[model samples]
Target: MDAVSERLAEVHGGIARALKDAARTDAAQLVAVSKTFDADAIRPLIAAGQRHFGENRVSEAADKWPALTAETPGIVLHLVGQLQSNKAEAAVRLFDVIHSVDRPSLVTALGKAMVASGRRPDCYIQVNIGAEDQKGGCAIADLPALLAQARDAGLPVIGLMCVPPADVEPAPYFALLAKLARDHALAGLSMGMSSDYPTAVLLGATVVRVGSALFGGRG
Candidate 1:
């Protein structure tokens, strides 16, 4: 197998083991984060049966994915980074799921864009579980209001998403996010990454954003 295929196999193996340990077989989905990587690097993983891929920026995705997806079928694209209100229409057109709907304004924009484009991608409310200044997520106290806005605007919101503080143990944050999703009766939890996905699965993550593990470090 090629390098990317090998890495993908290893990541899939890890996911399987984690699910089996958690008794959560098929409960979670792995979103191979393809941010910063070019299409050449991504094709092998697709050949290896990776269906879900995530990109951070709309412009970069626009540059490659239209042609890529047209050539390859069954590829689900996810927007796993901060989104601008101005780009909502483009995002709705390209992404199957958006994992960074953090505020009421963004929720409104996405709803409007979805209407305009006749596309409603599943959205995940990003919660700043760590409350970090540099991070892009709704404050924990603001999650309810944001979620309400999304629902009122008829957005197809699926669940909650969070990125834990890098220096701290991530389990607590993941657990808290799962609890928040449950409290709101949301069905999806988009949490975890290369370092802590297994822990996330154990803590009830329905979607894990794994980048480095599958594609190596971002270029």
Candidate 2:
């Protein structure tokens, strides 16, 4: 096996172990992020039984989905980055879940795209738990209103998605999302990344998106 494959195996095994130790009833979903990677690089991962992947750029995802899907049937694709309003239509066609619906305009566009395409993909409302000015997420105080609006507008708001503060521990942020999901009666938490996923899992992350650890350093 190649280095990337080995790393993927290690990560997957780690996730499994985390789930076991956490006493989680369901195994954590590992989204092997495939952004900045082409089908050639991802084909081996598919062969190794990886069915879930996340991508950031709409254009790159568009380029990779077809060939990757053809080679590995039933793969789940998630758009996990800030999606532009203009790319809503194409994104509706490509992704099975959208983990970055942060703005009102984007949600409107996604609702329209879903209406046009007849595909209501699962959505996660990105929350700026850290209150970072640079992140693409709704403010904590704004979540209830935004989630209510998104749901009423036909977006299937599954749960909250967040990136924790860079230097602090992730457990608190992950716990915050889990509590919010409970308050809202949601089912998932698309938190964590390559660096802090174990903390996320322990804190009740139903879905974790890991990129560099699975696909290696991206361009």
Candidate 3:
């Protein structure tokens, strides 16, 4: 096996171990965050039976994934980055899941796009868990209204997502996100990346977005 394949195995092993340790052997799903890498870099993981992958930019994904998906069946593409309202139509057309549904306007745009195209992707409300100015998520106070609007617009809002404050202990934020999901009755928790995913899974992460741990550092 190649280095990437070995890394994939290690990450999967970590996930399985994390789940077992948390008494959740089957609760969480690993989404290989395949943002910057091209098809050649991703082939090993696909050959090793990875089906779920995530991308950051729709334009970049459009350039690479059409050919990749044509070759590999059962590839579930997820949009895991900040999405502009203008890209809603293309995003709706491409991704099977969207983990950044944060605003009422975006909800409206996605709803209209899905209506016109007859495709509805599963959505997760991204909360600005750190309330950082640079991050993209709905303010904590706006979540209830935004979620209601998303549901009203016929969105399949299944979960909550957050990239906590960088370089801090993420456990508190993960716990807070879990509490919020419970309060709102949402099912999935799209938290965790390469580093703190084990903590996230322990706290109730149904979907962990693992990138660097699987693909290594991206340039």
Q: Candidate 2: minimum summed lDDT over ten consecutive residues — where?
A: 64-73
Per-residue CA lDDT of model 1 for 1-219, tens digit only, reads 878788888877887888889887567898999999999988888888899999999999999899889988889999999999999999999999999999877888899998888988989999999999999999999989999999999888899999999978999999899889989999899998999998998888889999999988765
- The TM-score that candidate 1 achieves is 0.97
Task: List lDDT for all candidates, in order.
Answer: 0.91, 0.89, 0.93
Give the clashing residue pairs of candidate 2, or none: none
Which numbered prediction scores highest in TM-score against the true structure? 3
Q: Candidate 3 residues 1-219, lDDT tens each?
A: 878779888887887788888887567888999988988999888998899999999999899999999999999999999999999999999999999999888999999999999999999999999999999999999999999999999999999999999899999999999999999999889999999998898888999999999988999
Higher-lDDT candidate of 1 and 3: 3
Displacement of the residue 137 alpha carbon in candidate 2, Å: 0.5
Model 3 regions lying over 4 Å from their true place:
none
Model 2, C-alpha of 34: deviation from truth (Å): 1.1
Overall local distance difference test of candidate 2: 0.89
Error of 3 at 51 (Å): 0.8
Q: Residue 83 lDDT in model 3? A: 97
How well does candidate 3 match the true structure in TM-score terms?
0.97
Candidate 1: give the clashing pairs.
Answer: none
Predictions ranked by lDDT, top down? 3, 1, 2
